[model samples]
Target: MDFGFTDEQKILRQTFKKFCEKELTREYVAWMDENCDFIPDELYKKLADLGLFGMIIPEEYGGSGMTFTDYMIAMEELSTASVAAGICAGLAVSFGAKVIGGMGNEEQRRFHLPKMAAGETKYCLALTEPGGGTDIINAMKTTAVKKGDNYVLNGQKVFISGGNVADYMLVVALTDPKAAKRTKAMSVFVVDAKTPGITVNLIKKVCIHACGTTEIFFEDVVVPAENMLGVENNGWNKLVDVLNPERIGTAMLSLGIAKAAYQAAHEYSLERYAFGKPIGSFMVLQHYLADMLIEIENATNLIYKCCYLMENGLPYHMEAAMAKIVAGRASEIAAIKGMEILGGYGVCMEYDLQRHFRDYKQMVFSPISDEMAKNMIAQWTGLPKSY
Candidate 1:
C-alpha cells in the first residue's frame, strides 16, 4: 500500500500550518494559558469558518465531510502551534459533530450537527467519573433510569474536557445495572449542558489551561428518551468504536508537541554558543538531538500506520494503542531533552519549551495512560490481562 499523503491532504496540512502560523502566535498562547479560560469566541468562529470544526462531519450537516486521516492532519498542525487550541477544535469536531453524524437518530443529527458543524455550539464527551479512568466498564457509577418518556440521570463526571463551555455532552451511564455483562448494561445519552440539576465546575489544570477541563454533577437531571444515542445498552460498543480514532488523534497531538519541542531544541542548539562554540558542535548535545529525531520519526511512522489502517477500514485498535504510546513517550522525551538543551531558559515562563514540557507530561497520561496502552497491546497478543 502507498504510504504517502494524498495531494489534497498535503495541501490541507500546509494550509492549516499557515493558519496556525498567522493566528496562533506565542503571545496569544501564553495569554490563554495564563488566563486559563475557554477559547475566545472570535477565534473559535474563525476556526469554524475554515471548516476545521467539521472535518469529520458530513457536508449535508453543514460540515466538510473529511476523513479521519484528514482530521488528524489538521489536529497535528493546530497542536504544533498550541495544544490547547488543537484540543478545543478537535473536541468540537470529533466528539461533537462526528458522533452525532455517526450514531444519532436522524432528528438528533439534523438538530445538533448543523449547529455543531457551524461552531454555533460546542460539545464534550462526559465518560470519566471520579472513580474511573481506565477501568471505565467496571468502575462507571453513573446511572440513568427510564421514567415516563424520560430518563432521570444522577451521576458525576470528572476531567471532562471543555465541559464548562460545551453546550452539549455525550454522557455514558448505566441503564441495566443487573445485566450479566457490564458492557451491555451501559448506555449513552445526549444531555443539554443547561439542563436542570446539572452543575459544571471548572478544574484548574497545570497544562493545556485554555481547554477548561471540568467536573460535572448531575443531580436528578432529566433527559428525554429521544436523546438516547443508538439502542439502549449499546453505548459500550459505540464508545469502543470512537476510542480507536480518538487514540489516533491523541497520537497526532503528541507527535505535534514532540516535533515542536525537537525543532525548538535543534534551532536553539545551532544558534546558542557555549564556551565560544555553538552547542551543536558539542557531542553530547548532538547525541540528544539525534535521539530526539529518531524517536520523532518512529512515532510518526507508527501514527501513519494507524491512520492508514483507519482509512482502509482495517482493525486498528492495537495499532492505535501502539501509536499513542510511542507518540506520548516520544513527546515526553523531546520535552525533557528540549529543556535540557535550553538550560535555565527552559523553565522560564517567557519560553514556550516549558509549556511544551508541562503539556507533554499531562498528555502522556491522558486519553489513555502509557501503562494502559501496554496492557492493551498485551491483551491483543493473547496474553493474560495485566491490569
Candidate 2:
C-alpha cells in the first residue's frame, strides 16, 4: 500500500509547518524554558485562530471536523516545534475534545466542545494515583459515590498533566468494588476545576518544565449525573478504547523530540571541526548519525502504521503497543547520540538538546512502560514476550 500523502494532506502539513516556524520558533521555546511557564496566552489564542483545537472535532460541533490522519499531521508539525507546546494543545483537542465529543450528550457537547475547540478551556486526565503507577486497574483508590442527585468524589490524583491550569478534568473512579474482577468497575466523570472541595497542587518535575503537572484532591467534590461519560460501573471500555489514539499521539511526540535532537546533532557535527576537518567527517560521528536516522525512521513507520490500521478499522492493539514501546527507546537513543555530538554543550539549558534530552526521557515512561507493551504483544501474538 502507498503511504504517501495526498495533495490535500501535503498542503495541510505545509500550512501547519509554516505556522510552527512563524509562531513556535527555537527562541520562543527557549524563553518558555527559562520562565518555566505554560504556552503564552497569545500563542494559545493564535492556535485557536488556526482552528488547531478543532482539528479533530466534527464541524457540526463547531469544529473543523477533520480526520485523525489530519490531526496526526498537525501533531507532528507542532511536536517538531516543541513537545510541551504541541502536547499542551494536542491533548486538549484529541483526548479532551474528541473523547467528550464522541460520548458527551448534545447539551454537554454544545457547551463544552466549542469552548474547548476555541481554546477557551483546557482539560486534564486524572487516572494515576499516588499509590497506583502502572497497576492502574487494581490500584485505583479514588472513589465517586452516588449521593442523592450528585456523585461525591473523594480521592487524589498525582502527576496529572495540565492539571494545574486545566478548566475541566476527566477523572476515572470505581463505581462498584465487587463486579470489578474482570476489568475493574470504573467510570469517567467531568468536573469543573472551580468546583468546591477540589484542590490542584503543582508538581515539581525535572522535565516538561513548561507544562504544569499537579496533584489533585477531591474531598466530597460533587459531580452531577449529566457529567458521566459512560455507563455506571462500565467505564473500563471507554478508558481502554481511548488508549490506542493516546498512545499514537505519545509515540508521535517521542518522534518529534528525537527529530529535534537529530537536527541539533547533525548541525553540531558539521560545524565543530577537529584535527584537519569537521567532526562530521569522522567515521565515528558518521556512524552515530546513521544510527540515529535508522531509529527515527523505524519508529516513525511503526507509529504511522498503527494509526493507519486503527483508522481503517483493524485489530491494532499489539501494533500500537509496539510503536509506543519502540519509540521510547528511539527517543532515548537519539537524545544520547545528539548529546554525544554536542559533548558538554548538549547538557546546557541554552541549547535545545538538553531540554530535548530531558523531555524525551520522560516520554519513555508515560502512557505505559516497555515491559508492559511486550507483555501485551506476547499475549496477542503468542510470541512469548519477556522483559
Candidate 3:
C-alpha cells in the first residue's frame, strides 16, 4: 500500500491549509467564540464552494467524491484553524451525507444527498439521550411505533450537534421490543425539523461553542415510514457502520486540536524570553516540544491508517477505535502541556490554546469515550472487556 498522499491529495491539503490561514484565522475564530453564535452562513457557503461539505459523497449525488484520506486531511486543517469549524464540517461531510449515501434507498439518496451536498440541508445524528450516554446500544430508550405509513416517535435526544439548526435529523429508536439482543430491533428514521411534535432546545455547552448542540424532545413526532433507513429493525448494524467512520473523523478532531495547541506553545516558547534567552532554547522546553511532536505524528499516522481502512472497505472497527483512543489521549496531553508552557495565559480564552484545550476535552467524551474504545479493543483481542 502506498504510504504517501497522491499529488492531487497533496494539492487539496495545501488548498485547505491556505483557506484556513486566510479565512479561518484566529481573529475570526475569536469573534465567534466571543459572540457564541453558529458559523456564518457565508463561511458555510465558502466551504461548500471548496467542496468541503460533500468531500465524501459521489458525484452523482452532487459531491466531489473524494477519498476518506482527503476528508481526514481537510478535517485536520479545518480543526487547525478552528476546532468548532472542524467539528461542523467533519459531521456534515463524513456522517450527514453518508447516512443517505450508504443506507438510504435510491429515491432517498436522489432526494437528500444533493441538497446535503449543496449545503442546503445540514444533517445531525440524533442517537444520544440524557440517560443513554455511552450505553447507546442496548440502553437506548427511544421508541418508534408503526402508524399506518408513518412512524410515531417518542423520545428525547441530548448533546446533539446541529440539533437546533439542522434541516433534518437522523434519529435512532427501538422498533421491535422482542427482537434478540444485538440484532434487528433498532431502527433509524429521518425526521424533518419542522415536524409538529418535535421540540429543540439549545443546550449551553462549555466548548466547541461555534457548533450548535441541543436537546430534542420527540413527542409522537410523525416520520414517514418511507423515511426509515435500511430495514425497519436492522438499525443496530447501520448505526455501527455509520459510527466507525464517525470515530475516524473524531480522531481527526483530536489530531487537529493537538497540532493547533502545539503550534501555539511552540510559537510562544520562541518569542517569550526567560533568563536572557528564548524559552525554547532551554533543554527542558525542547524535550517537551519534541515529545508533543512525536505524539502528534504517531496519533496522526494511526488516524490516516483507520481512514484508509474505512475507504478501502477493510475490516477496521478495532483499528478505528484504537485510533480514536490514541488521538484523544494524545490531544488532551498535548493541550495540557501547551497550557503548562503558556503558564497563566494558557487558560485565558483570548488565546487559542485554551479553546483547543476545552474542545479537545469535549472530543474525548464524544462519539465514543476512551474507556469505551479500550473496551472495544479488548473485545477485539478476544479478552474480557470492561470499561
Q: Kindly report which residue pairs in candidate 2 clash with one another.
A: none
TM-scores for the candidates = 0.97, 0.96, 0.97
Cα deviation at 20, candidate 2, in Å, is 1.2
Off by over 4 Å in 3: 385-387
Sorted by lDDT, highest first, which candidate order results?
1, 3, 2
Model 3 weakest lDDT span, ten residues long: 90-99
List where candidate 2 sits over 4 angstroms from the true fold.
180-184, 383-387
Error of 3 at 194 (Å): 0.8
What TM-score should be assigned to candidate 3? 0.97
Which is the leading candidate under lDDT? 1
lDDT of 3 by residue, 140-218 (tens): 7889999899899998999999787788899999999778774578998888989999999998877888988999999
Cα RMSDs of all predictions? 1.3, 1.7, 1.4
- Model 2 whole-model lDDT (C-alpha atoms): 0.84
Q: What C-alpha lDDT does candidate 3 achieve relative to the native structure?
A: 0.85
TM-score of 2: 0.96
Model 3 clash tally, residue pairs: 0
